[model samples]
Target: MGSITERLSKKDIEFIENQKMFFVSTAPKDGKINLSPKGLDDTFKIIDENKILWLNYFGSGNETAAHLLEDNRMTIMFCAFDGEPNILRLYCKAKAIQERDDVWEEYISHFSTKRAARQVFEVTIENVNNSCGMGVPLYDFIGQRDDLTNLYNKMSKEEHITYMKKKNLVSFDGKDTKLFED
Candidate 1:
């Protein structure tokens, strides 16, 4: 199928992560769908069938979290490594828990850094599929990045949310992202 999910086996998780990058796509009813290429350690967490989590770093815009606020739908994809034939995708609805929320403490602890991570979005995964990513190329894991870490560290809390309001409040398609408030 062009786009679908198959349940993940325990062994599948190890292989799925071999790829260097994964894409996260989100959108609201009438705007642009944000497909972000996420690298480094800021990616997926298979907490359980009904729960997944990802650290949303401060970026040019907070469209991803905003989209989740408007609508819980989200999709994460992992392609195969070394041109192996496999493609995995997970579909779910999400809730973005902000820094002020109590849940932030437990989830963010998994990460080594505590800079401009605005929030951790929790997903209740609905489906998982491992299709053949035979066309996907292989890549090696280099390491984590310090540049992002330093940049986020440089900004104060007020500045971070202010930046978000200006850039992330609405999806490019003119749909409201509801980035700041509940």
Candidate 2:
């Protein structure tokens, strides 16, 4: 059976904290829909029962940020990949808070990461759904990957900004992510 609620319960928060990875989904008005798997530690924070913050790093595409600029609709999903058969989905309205933004420092303090974060997404959860994930296959737990961290550590701040300008400022569909805009 499936259940729907307006706010995250203690059990739901525990499940989210235990997960090693989660998926973020978003879509442009007339272009590609983006679904990304996030696994970096200290990049996710629960603000309250209805709001959460997600730290987004410089990636190949800025689809989520671009989509959020056009439309705030976003969904985050978590699954029990090793233990119980369960899936949780949070439907939300999200906004991208870039490093250049005034409120960046306010939310950035909630996370503890040395990586060059492209933006922080402030997501307000509108609905929560939990379902029995019986059809989902189980996978064993493994340690987190340090390749990205190692690579990031070796780059200078200027290099990081240059990479973001080339890759993180635009979406695959040619939409402006407003990553560096004022």
Candidate 3:
């Protein structure tokens, strides 16, 4: 059975910080669900008991951002794959803050290093829950892949913008992400 809480406890925060990866799920009112695996150190931060921030990097699609625009509902899940069997889920309302947004600089500072940062997802926690993940299989911890960062870093500013316009501006279901729109 799972237990629900209003906010994250000290123990929960510690577990979150130690995890190497997490999953983000979102969906529009009538489109396909989007569940993405997120990794890379320093990409996620806990602002408070009821708030968290995730720095999103360039990806093949911008489903999360698009879905947030359509409906703010989002859920982030973290699993303990190498240690004790546990799972944590934060039910939240998320806002996608694009690089062009005025508050981008403020939120981006939370990350030590930035590369190909597409957006900053500000999540307002609505509910926190934990369940025994005894069924989750253990996996060895490996280092993060640097290919995505390296590819984006190699592009010039104009090229990067063009790339985003072509690739990251729309969801797979044809919803506008509004990433570059004024």
In terms of TM-score, which candidate is strongest?
A: 2
Model 1 pairs in collision = 5-129, 6-128, 6-129, 31-173, 82-138, 85-133, 85-134, 86-133
Q: How many residue pairs collide in each prediction?
A: 8, 0, 0
What candidate 2 gets wrong by more than 4 Å, as runs, is: none
Error of 2 at 87 (Å): 0.3
Model 3: which ten-residue window has the lowest total lDDT?
155-164
* TM-scores, each model vs. reference: 0.82, 0.98, 0.96
lDDT of 3 by residue, 52-146 (tens): 88999877899998999989999999999988899999999999998888999999999987767889999999999999999999999879998
- The number of residue pairs in model 3 that clash at the backbone is 0
Selected candidate, larger lDDT, 1 vs 3: 3
- lDDT of candidate 1? 0.73
lDDT of 1 by residue, 102-147 (tens): 7779998877766777678887777887777766766766676778
lDDT (Cα atoms) of all candidates against the true structure: 0.73, 0.91, 0.91
- TM-score rank order: 2, 3, 1
Least accurate stretch of 10 residues (summed lDDT) in model 2? Answer: 111-120
